[model samples]
Every structure is written in C-alpha cells, then in structure tokens.
Target chain A: MKVKAFLLGVLALAGVFVGFDLQNSHGTSFAAKKAANYDESVTLPMAKYPETGKHIKDAIAAGHSAVCTIDRGGAADRRKESLKGYPTKPGYDRDEFPMAMCKEGGKGADIRYITPADNRGAGSYIGNHVENYPDGTKVLISVK
Target chain B: MNKLLISYSQLIITNTDEEHSSFQWSDEDVKRGYSVQRGAVAIEAINNDESEIEVIVGSYLPSEKATVTYSLPFPVRADSIIVTSPGAVTLPFSVPKGTYQLHVEAIPLQQPTDDGLFPVRYQLYFDTNGSK
Candidate 1:
C-alpha cells in the first residue's frame, strides 16, 4: 500500500508540471499569432486647399479687403485653415477663400507663408499683422 | 544584448518662394498660416548586434492622403557596432500644409527575433505658410 501511494503522488506531480508547460506554450503561441497579424496602415482623406474668392481678388485689385469675423465656433477651423498653403496664385473668380488673416484679441492676424530658406534650415515664417480694430473684429487680407 | 538605437532625426523644409521666411514653432503657435513647399527628413541610427538588420523609415500624412516608405539593410559585426548618419531623403512629393505621423522600425534579418524589437513613431505638423 505504501508503494502504491508513493507512485500516485509522483503521477500527480508530473501531471501538474505537464499542465503548466502546456499553459505556457499556449500563451506564447497566442501572443505570436497576435503579433503576426498586426496591421500598420494609416488612412486619411486627401487634403483640399480653399479656393480664392472673386470678391477677395477684386478687393485686393482695388486695394480694398474683405474681412470675415470668425465666430468662436469657427475660430479653431479658421486657425487650421490659416496654416494651409496660400493659393498658388490668387484666383480671379473662384468662390472659396483659402488664405486669411487670424486675429485674437485686439491684435493683428498671424500670417504664415513658406519661406525661401535652404532645405537644411527652417523654411516657414509666422509674422503678426496687427489690425487697427478691437478683438473679434473681422479683417480682410489681400495681396496688394 | 543586441539592440538598435535611433540617435537623431529632423524635418527640414525648403521654400523656393521669396515672399516667406521660416520661423521657429512654439507650442502656443497653433494658430496657422504656417506652410512649407518641400520637406527633407533625416534620421541617424546605430546597430549594436552581431547580425545584419533591416531598417525602415515611413512617413504618413493622413490629411494629405500620402504615405512614404523606404528600407535599408545594415550590417553589423559581432562584438562591434554599426553607426549610420545618413543624409536626408527628400520626399518625392510636397508635404502639403497639414499634420503628419512618422514611423520608424528596425528588425533583425534572422529568425527567432523578438516581436517588440525596435520601433519609434511621432507626430509633426507642416504648413506651406512657413511656420517651422
């Protein structure tokens, strides 16, 4: 009876070890499968630049400007649009406004444009153009 | 004890137009007009391994709907390190005024490599309006 009990105890210990090994292998296999199927793709829509407005061109030609008072809701979008490229050339009769002056408080709009600097150094400029109006005032930006 | 290290990286914009100048960017300078017509990106890396490794540099512009991918093989000797200070690779296409995410990955050419090896990624904003 003593020998039989000893043999049973050894079998139980062996079974425990085998179970632990199986669990570890299964976990590793699961992790490897997950890593093998990793997806590294990023998708984004094509960016569209705003078109030049006919009125804006007319104003610029006439040495006048049109201003859009960017309401609070439109402030963030306007700020983003302001960072976009200046129309390659001002559109003569287009219906969209791609470039504009951005103002916060009673200060001038921050106008940014691509610089002609070397490729090894910085290549853009951000200059502030103070408008002669109070905060929340609409200012028109035009090329004279 | 083998590893890959990214030592340095930078994004450069070169504008051909004279009406604009480049300015350093600040965290609070999110109000835009910043723009760039061309971008040259450079990355430096080192391999501290006994075997050859592959390095991949990828740039993804979600808003502009563009992705750039390039790969190079790096050879390293046992008990020795390989350092690379590669020149900037000019993008074939212009990086329009928008934000972009850049990803870099390195892996050993041999099998039995760790899945979580060398990976790095970051975000950048570009504008044709010249805000650096």
Candidate 2:
C-alpha cells in the first residue's frame, strides 16, 4: 500500500509541472497558434564604453525614437547626408542610430562620436544578431 | 452578441526608450490584406512593459470597457505589429482579408505589474462595408 501511494503522489506532482509548462507556452497568442519567430533583441555594451552609452542614452532622452527597421539600401547616401557638416575627431568614429542602413535613418538622425573599438565592437555585435534579418524587422536595443 | 476573435491574457511589450512609446498598426499592410478595404490602429501611452491587445473582427462593436478611445483616419499597412524593448513581443493577431473600422481603447490598469508593466486592451473590430 505504501509503495502504491508513493507512486501515485509522484505521478500527480509530475502532472502539475507538465500542466504549468503547457500553460506558460500557450500564454501568448502567437505561441497558441504558431511558434512566433523573432530576432529583435540587441545588447549594448555600456560598461565597455561609457561615452558610447551616454550618447545613445542622451539621443533617446532627447526624443529621437529608435527606429527598429533595417533598410540597408541607400546607406551611403543616408550617411553622407547625416555627416555633411559633422566634425570628426581624432581616434573617434561617429555612430548613429537608425543607422544609415535603416529605412528611418537619413539626414537629422542621431549621431554620436565614440572610440573606434567601442564603435566597431557595438556594430559587430548588432550585426551578428540581425545582419540577415529582413528590412522592417523590428529591433530592440538594450543599453546594458 | 460580439464574438471574441482573439483573447490574450498578457501582451508583452518592450519599453525600449521614451521615444519609441506607441504600438502602431500598419495601414499599408492592411491595404494589402484586403481586396478593397483595410484599417489600422495605433495605441499611445503604451510604456507598460506588457499589456493585453484584444480585437474583434466581423462582429458588432463591444461595450465601452476602456478609459479612452480613438479611430484612425487613414488605414495602416501591416499584417502585424512588433515591439521589443527590454522583454516585450508583439501580441500577434492576424485578421482575415476584409474592410475594417479600426477602433482602439487604452485602459490603464489600476494595478500595474511588479515590473511596472502597463496593460492596454486593444479592441479592433472588422466587418463588411468599410469604404476604401
């Protein structure tokens, strides 16, 4: 009798966990219908480059909405338009959000100058995650 | 009786920054979805980490259960909308092709989640006869 009771208790406990897992997965409408696929999270290295972080935080603070779409078309033209009169400093690179590759990027986009290492590092990290994502793919920039 | 097309208990949203504050439907996408008619909705003050966005299609408009409401002038173009900030995703809802009158409601939950997540109920109703 003791052995049978113990087995039933364990089975009940296992069932509870399985139920919780299913409920969690189906909590979202997308998951309930079809597994939603997304590649929108991008991490920012704030500690590695405080200045770089400050520039982005400030731009976001000043009402420059982060445009999440990636266009990759007319990037050179957009970059040229935004950098027409911008000053470049020694040992620094000008970084902009709504990057020249984004459909939202162009003249008047947010621009910040930071070290080449920090600038390139950030760019590479973002590209690794979203390089192949289609245009208009929403992106979430996490300033960590 | 208004039929419930989609119901979501929790809608996740990533409040990336203050500037990216609203979740807007794509009018252009709507145009593509419908053969002759389409619609879209944009909800403001949606800084909440997550909120419930619910809509009804091909039925009568439901009762007023929102603090405020708005109707878009020109339709938006989008089969869906996506938002990603810290830990938010789109409340994925796909509607069948037809003309729609986009109605939205923003109900600020009296009690926000521990993470300060705001929940907004987006009720979009679609039926026939919405002019192009």
Q: Which candidate gets the maximum TM-score versus the true structure?
A: 2
Error of 2 at B56 (Å): 60
Residue B45 error, candidate 2, Å: 43
For all candidates, state DockQ relative to the true structure.
0.04, 0.01
Local distance difference test, candidate 2: 0.47
Per-residue lDDT of model 2, residues A2-99, tens digit only: 99999999999998897678768767643433332333556676876566567777877777655466654455456556555655554455677656
lDDT of 2 at B59: 45
Alpha-carbon shift of residue B13 in model 1 (angstroms): 10
Q: TM-score, chain B only, every model?
A: 0.21, 0.46
Categorize the docking of model 2: incorrect
TM-score of every candidate relative to the true structure:
0.20, 0.39
- Please write out the lDDT profile of model 1 over residues A1-144, one tens digit for every residue: 999999999999998898677768878655443444321111111111111222334534554323444333233334334333423221111112222222231122333222212111221111112212333544334332
- Which structure among the candidates has the greatest lDDT? 2
Worst 10 residues of 1 chain A by lDDT: A41-50
